[model samples]
Target chain A: MKTIKSLHARHHELSDTHHQLEVLNSEIFTRHYLPTFREKLKTSGLLPLKPTGIEVFQMNVGYMCNQTCKHCHVDAGPDRTEVMTKETMKQCLEVIINHTIKSVDITGGAPEMNPDFRWFIEELRKEYSGEIIVRCNLTIILANGKYLDLPDFYKKHNIRVVSSLPFYNADKTDRQRGEGVFAKSIEALKMLNKAGFGKQDTGLILDLVYNPSGAFLPAEQSLLEADFKRELKDHFDIEFNNLLSITNLPISRFLDYLIETDNYEDYMEELVLAYNPKAAEGVMCRNTISVDHAGNLYDCDFNQMLKLQIESKAGTHISEFDLESLNERNIVINQHCFGCTAGAGSGCQGTTT
Target chain B: MQKTYYDPADLKKFGDIAEYGQDLADKFFNWYNDVFKDGALSSREKCLIALAVSHAIQCPYCIDAYTSDSIKRGASEEQMMEAVHVAGAIRGGASLVHGVQMMNKAKKMLM
Candidate 1:
């Protein structure tokens, strides 16, 4: 059950140009949530949130994935044919090498599925000395013959692997991701452990990510990390370096879930009520730029998925790289930004606080 | 001019107890804050415990506060409901177990 295919089949995706997110145009989510969020920010003295600077360059390689998770904002899946061609990738590399970007986080339905994924990393390593992160969905390691050596590949390149494991147990994870995903994920983790990916002394980092199974904010990151560490270690002897707790933004399939369950208003209300200005100031958008498969730039991955390209005169495509103009650009925000500011706040790197 | 039981707004003004006796209220507030801080049990677990106890005591304000607090801290609706059930079972058991005492007294007196 690929995420994009399943979501499209279920929601009858409105337009291809909208990245299949046009179904989120319901007035209630847009009109109602925005006013409430604006009012809350007004109360918290955090009105008019603006970007700080970009340090991280997040690239979405494609929308092809092995698994279709329910809460996935990407709506990535196997049936999708979209992929980042070598030409666009070259443009991205040119921008990265010329700029002072600190991190390059590669993501996709499963970024490894891209034929040029390894070659691109190798190329980046040649020029960029900064951190390189791969947003992996663990099951991908066990998906096919080509991916069997992913752990070894990651080790050789010293790429940080950040994988998603919805829960410590199989039942919850399988229920969210797919039927057989949990067992495969565990097997993959054990492989990572064998490869020294999660070992303490090893610089090769392996971080697991957690997102709520339903419409709720994530629990405290530290506590959840402890629980995950204990359960995974005691049960399967799985070891990981860190756990990232991410808030589920109301976009893509998650937004569809909100609408389908009629929890859109209530969930938005919870986000607004839990607004913390400290979190807003540290939002990933303030320090990161998200570039989509077509080489278009955005303030964050969420903005990219929504097609909210950078509002600047230098042009939003990577071919027109203007670090000075991008640095001065104001971040584009909406009601959904409350997801990043709620509770401890959330971002690609986990809790902002 | 106005009389009502359990005003919803009273939950927000809970700190106003200091209005009557400033010293004791300050002590209570500090104690309350310390008790809820992260410790042997996380604030999240403590919120669940508080939610269960609120149901047992039938305190509307505690329920409202802890309901929002637990949700803000990431407790699911299902988990919250399960906690309330735990409280219900305890309260129900507390009443049911005393029947053993009633039976013992009845046998002793009648005989």
Candidate 2:
């Protein structure tokens, strides 16, 4: 008989191995621990999750990011080389144009890090008329000389920049992100402001994302937004259109933290205990389709990260999108679905309910 | 059917108090709601204060609730801990300050 050590046992520190973490996810989110997420939803009349519409097409360009945050579900970092090729981008563009997606969201380890990112966006601008969102980690804006003109580029294209800033101050923000990240993020925000990103009626919308730095659900969006607005303005003289409070999904680095710190079961229980049917109804997966760097499709970004492909007879790839069939297909879900349905509910656009 | 002084599960049933008696429970909830809202001090500040008091009173329920409340309300780990330290300082000083009475009484009798 042969035995393999659990990923948690094999390594003493956090590392990104999708399969390893996926195995852990399977083990941790089981019926023995609690009722299956689907069962919980069925009890509340929200089972058999299905798509509402494809209003947003979110594309994960790659797995390369500048900073490796502790709670990043994507496990994006500097070393990741899995980037979307020009061919895939072309296919994605075809889907966006043909489907006429109302909003096309681009994400990544850092979407901008993709070599074809600018080219793809430029090509996308040529045909797509809807809103384009870039999920940027602000540090990337100041990463190097090559990225210095990013704010200007976003402004030039009227891109709605949605960036993550864990907290308003250096201490908390830096602790969650990496060291000196707070300062650089501030400088980037100032640059975006200079480019008319966050100003009122500027038509250059800038949004900030806030996720809890530890094992907890985010506070009410409006109150936290007000606090962020006041603190950022008073201290850094920074400005943004709105703050989106997002729940940290239990996956990737966060899952490791929960398991290692002996908080996994408790955290899952909290999410299950706070299950909100209203939120489940408005889950982003219902309206958004996620496309990975490889051009494969999933119900949402969380599903995409977990390698859960959309199940359809036609196929789940950018080249073969049967919008009708996808609309009718059952949305694949697991315990991670709780992150989107818990409490006020979390989505790419912020609180669902 | 088991009975205990404290059940961790009961924390989730805190809102069920209104089920037993709606009138008084409603009043308590309304007052509690009003107290935590943004006033002269921000809600985050109120949470920090609540966190400190929760520690001083040493109520595990309050501590658990406010710890999550404070973090959710944007209180940093450092800020939250500092709030706890403030509670500790005040509590410690409270006992130490009473030492003056002991010193005065001893001086009057011995000196």
Candidate 3:
């Protein structure tokens, strides 16, 4: 099942890459994609780092999401069985209690899907006393009976909600998120806004995520945010705090989409050529510690997918997390890194520029 | 369909590698800076060519970065499209050339 599943993911990738050359050649995509932005430049080694403290810790609760967006890198779906267990959540909380970690970022297919999510949040509220970030799909809250009041719940706890709304246009959003998702998401956003999620001075923080619909990194986050803010306000009457432009890493379902579509070569070449050292200076993996549902620690979610164990060697799981020891862990890396460091750079929060 | 398995999204993991030892990342890094340097090619020229080469080697990160870079450098839509085509030709040629090996085998068998 694992191999077959990986194969399915691989097929999606081939599809994305294949689209450029349906027939023999004369492909425009590859040529436009490579030789990189680095040619005619210099290359440097040993990426620099500026520590941000273990002030923030983010967890991927599971792979179950309400919307199976086409470009979703997680490949999360209704059947994925990888949600973090409540026990694991406790382990995470233990770290919060013991460490100076100031914030917690929770993400997943719809991190809200985890059965004990509400309970977990309550635990954090009562115990951690730090900022909480919830990366929501928005539509999940409207998925069914149990989730209907999540927006209000989030507001009561003062959790920061970072929602994904790919585009302002219904067709584009639906195309990416799933049929009718655009409307449902907008409705959910309304619930959030009513609770002052994106309102002025409410301190109910609401940030939106904007990832490219195709095989490209997003434009400047500031520029894209301005456009998104303008468009969403004008059309859907939607208002959010900020837009984080993430350069989608080549992994999981998104990787499969690229390969399945034949967008592989050209896209990789583009990333290589545009290899901006400036972007590399701030790749999120340098500072972020990604905790999987099972308590296994990874440098970032991308490294998690490849199962590249962190170099700390104190051991892999969260049970072994010595904040000091975890700090000692050497973040695993690979060629896929160019994506994060290529442009202005990408991270869970937004461009790291 | 011979089935190609390249993932451009992989390009997103841009700086995580040590290509050709440590120098790979370092060299690429310096070249990247040079490309953006205010000189003959302009960042736009560097972007298009990078995009083209990205196709030749097929790095998704490169593809993603250069695609954005080209647009930022003020490359016309048509020009970017044409650059991709240029890459397609080289890739196709590389692939079909293997047909010569097949042809050689077939002729030798017939002879």
**TM-score of each predicted structure versus truth:** 0.85, 0.86, 0.70
Question: In candidate 1, which residue pairs get closer than 3 Å at backbone N, Cα or C atoms, i.e. clash?
Answer: A3-A68
The best candidate by DockQ is 2
Tens digits of per-residue lDDT for model 1, A1-353: 32335565556552242633443344655554345556666676655555666789899999888988888888788766678988999998998998888999999979999999999999999999899999999889988888999999999888999999988887778878988888999999999999999988988899999998777788889878998999899999989999999999988878878778987777776777778888877888888888888888999988877778888679999888787888778777767788999989999899999
Better of 1 and 3 by lDDT: 1
**Model 3 lDDT tens row, A126-243:** 9777889999888888788899999889998999999888777776677677788888889999899999999999999999988777676676777678778887889888889998
Predicted candidate 2 versus true structure: per-residue lDDT over A131-225, tens digit per residue: 99999898888888999999999987879999999888887887778788889899999999999999988999999999888788898899889
True contacts kept of 2: 0.83
Residue B47 accuracy (lDDT) in model 2: 90
Interface RMSD (Å), every candidate: 2.2, 1.2, 4.0
- By TM-score, the candidates rank as 2, 1, 3
In candidate 2 chain A, what residue range of length 10 has the lowest lDDT sum? A1-10
Relative to the true structure, candidate 1 has a C-alpha RMSD (angstroms) of 4.4
Stretches of candidate 3 above 4 Å error? Answer: A1-43, A47-53, B1-111
Task: Please give me the DockQ of candidate 2 compared with the native complex.
Answer: 0.67
Give the Cα error of residue A306 in candidate 3, in Å: 1.8
Candidate order by decreasing DockQ: 2, 1, 3
